[model samples]
Target: MKKPIKKQKAVLIILLSNIFIAFLGIGLIIPVMPSFMNIMHLSGSTMGYLVAVFAVAQLLMSPFAGRWVDRYGRKKIIIFGLFLFGVSELIFGVGTNVSVLYISRILGGISAAFIMPGVTAYIADITSVQERAKAMGYISAAISTGFIIGPGIGGFIAEYGVRLPFFFAAAIAFLACFSSIFILKEPLTKEQLAEISAKTKQTNFISDFKRSLNPHYFIAFIIVFVLAFGLSAYETVFSLFSDHKFGFTPKDLAAIITISSIFGVVVQVFMFGKMVDILGEKKMIQLCLIIGAILSVASTVVSNFLGVLLVTCLIFLAFDLLRPALTTFLSKAGGKEQGFVAGMNSAYTSLGNIVGPAMGGILFDVNIHYPYLFAAVILLIGLGITVMWKEKQLAESFAE
Candidate 1:
């Protein structure tokens, strides 16, 4: 049964709030990391490992997490994930050792793996097909808003103590967790979920992945990977690239990134859905790929601060738009398999996140510009793949 409009809006607000808080917690730790490294006597390589491990854990868990979401229930998984997120942040705040921090990150990864698919699947269940794209856009915007605000708040709170931000993050996560237990509703019934689970019964993760390679989903999955890969490559090296190439200060880099994120959020909230409705996902994806490729290459050549800022913002904006466009497409096509498909989408994205930064870092070591150039090349390849893509079977369904 669908929720009443007023009740549905309230539920969506709570769901988006949880998502915002979760990502905000992630952002809250960014500014304090340097102090963390110094206090803990951690090396750069150790920091890299910490970041990589989170993605690794998320990648491994997501397929199973998806299955669990379908078999269990979205509200249950979301509540569990929020509790885990709270615990992870609290552990990270208090822990003194690298091993403890790694444990905390792993839990955080698992929490993310659970929460993302659950929330996405839940949203898919509540909204009619016409509402899905706009709803997905809000999801992306909440995330970007968290990231945009997180560092600033983290930096300010770090005035008291470096660990304070983590504690604050933990507090909010716990608050959200408790609030959700009281407020959130399960959107699907047992029989509905049982049906979904039956439709998606694969023996293992490998089989799940193999099923994703079916013609209906294969192209979209590839686009998800390329989007993650190209965007990760550009972003992971952005600060270093700007600093190295243009002698930009930390404040300068922060301003550029913050401004870009704000712009991306604006577009997501106001324009993304309209664009999707007007142009369709296929066209929007193709256009964003072209934008990503051109702007990525543009970033390498632009020397002035404004020129670089504009190019960088445009590049990120392309990425921000591209992500939801893909998700909206997947949601439309996924039908009863929403949870499973959302899980695989998260998995492919994690796979790209794992590889992209590592490769970008390696290429950055070779030449500062290599990462952007590599991103452009990868995006062009994605664009090529999308050019021949045609959506026939799903087009009629999507039209409704």
Candidate 2:
């Protein structure tokens, strides 16, 4: 019992650190990218592309990332992902032109596609169904915390220059990567890795995706997509929105993001396990989407900073609820295809990121209100799907 507890603690530390670093990299950039666009004299549409480009790379690479996790082992892919993440931030920190920024984002996207799936699969490999949701909640809390603090740090550092935050993000990523190489242990031995890798290589994303389309959790994947899509609209244009509407400073943007993440982190870490136990994943998801949609749409109408912050807090709380619940749902439903399913989960999320910002960007340009309105509509569609989907049947199939 002591041995197992010690082992769980060690693995939890490693997994949580990886997620923190990855999201820290992402969060550090958020408050600064709008300024970057201004520095380059880029349009909202262009900025949207820059933001979505990372997910586009993720969308393209996630399938391969999933297979790589199954093939090469989670440790190798995670380390490589971390290294690439550092490289991407470093490139962005030195970026002078739009082209350089785009290249950097592509690298960042590829890195995310690898890291997200690898870390998720590694967690799934170690934990049991009973404990998986609790584990994911902690991981989600780490991600939210990273994203929260990163922009606060980045915003303060941006007093020097916007690009400096990317450098800072890179430094943290490299440190995390070093830790991974030195201390992280692979749960699977060489023989298990070789066998699993061999078996996974036979199938591609198309087949694997089709295979994942059983009655149980296909809607869950769609929910992930819709949730991300709705959120990225706000994410892609947040700094711009605040700047245009209320003349927000970088610090202000950081404050908003930090506050939001704090709300998310508290729920994900402390309340998530019991909440899911009481509400179940499906009910939790449905309620969150409904309220979140209402909040997303409401955000468009707020003229004051306090109102905006209030709505953002609620919206973020909803997102925090969804992230871990969805992760736990997929993990429980996944069974043996830990790597494959985790990869697909990231793929679906990447797909949302792809569409959300791209569409959000274009819409934000048209009218400040359009993006939020569209997000509300997208989530409403998701809510309907959640309402109509055969939960009892899916649950039964998943158990089988």
Candidate 3:
């Protein structure tokens, strides 16, 4: 049964709030990282390893998290994840040694694995197919907004104490977690659960991955991986690129990112769904790939700050649009298997996150421009994949 409009709206607001807080927590630590490293006397390699560890943990946990979301229930997984996220932040804030920080990051990654798929599946449960694109846009917007604001807030609060931001993030997460337990009702009822249960027998990650290779889903899944890989590759070294090429400071990089992110949020809120409606999912995906590919190369040639900022905004806008569009398309195709498909999506994304930065770091060492060039090549490949995608196959897969 469909939820009434007002209740649905309220539920979506709460869900987006949790998502915002989660990403906020992730971003809050970014500004404090240098400080933390100084305190621990950690090397740059250790910092890189810290990032890899989180992605690795998230990647390994995502498939199981997705399955649990389907089997146990979305609310259960979300609440549990939030609690884990809170505890992880608290540990990180207080810990003095490297090993404790690693443990905290691993737990943080596991929490993310649980939270992301659960939220996507929950949104699928609440919104109709026609309503999903806009809902997904809102989800993406909340995430972008949280991440954009988090660093600014973190930088400001760091004057009080370097560890304070993590504690603050933990407090907010716990508040959200408790609020959810009391207020967020399970969207799936008995009939929905039975239907989902019938379709989804317990399966391992490998089996689920193989199953996702069906004609309809394979292209979308590939798109997800390619998009994430390309974006992460582009972004991982962006600060270094700016500083190397243009002598940009931390404030300059932050300003560029902030402007781009704010523009992205405005577009997602005001124009994203309408544009998706006008362009259709396949065309929208293709267009975004084209934009990303072109601007990535353009980034290498821009000499002036304004030119760089403009190109960066366009690149990020393409990426921001692509994410929710893919999610909406997948949600429409997923039908009763929303959790399964969402899990697979998260897994592929984690794979991209892991590999993209590793490769980007290596390429950055060899040539400053190589990462952007590589990203362009990868996105062009994604564009080629989209060109071969067929709408009929998507409809037929859902019919099955």
Tell me each candidate's RMSD, in Å, in order.
1.5, 2.9, 1.3
TM-score of 2: 0.88
Q: What local lDDT score does residue 131 receive in model 1, on the 0 to 100 scale? A: 77
* Residue runs of model 3 more than 4 Å from their true location after superposition: 1-7, 397-400
Tens-place lDDT per residue, model 2, 1-400, is 1233235786679778988989988888876877888888999777767877887898878878888888878899999999999999999899888899899999999999889888988887787666777888988899888877777677788999888999988998899899889877886788987887766657576777786676566888888889888888767787777888889887777677778778889888878989988998889888989998899878878888799889988998998888888898888787656677788888898888777877887988899888888988998999998886676765774584
lDDT of each: 0.90, 0.83, 0.90
- The candidate 2 region of ten consecutive residues with least summed lDDT is 1-10
lDDT tens digits, residues 1-400, model 1? 5654345888999899999999999999999999999999999999999999889988888988888889888999999989999999999999999999999999999999988998889888888777788889999999999999999999999999999999999999999999999998788889988887787666378988988898677788899999999889989999999888889999999999999999999999999989999998899999999999999988888889999889988988999999999999898888777888889999999999999999999999999999999999999999998875676655843553
Q: Name every residue pair that clashes in candidate 2.
A: none
Query: Higher lDDT: candidate 2 or 3?
Result: 3
TM-scores for all predictions = 0.97, 0.88, 0.97
User: Residue-wise lDDT of candidate 3 within 1-400, one digit each (tens)?
Assistant: 6664355777888899999999999998899999899999999999999999998898888888888888788999999989999999999999989999999999999999988889999998888676778888998999999999999989888989999999999999999899999889888886777778777767687887888888768899999999989999999999999999999999899999999999999999899989988998889999999999999999999999999999999999999999999998888888777778788888889999999998898999999999999999999999999888777876675464
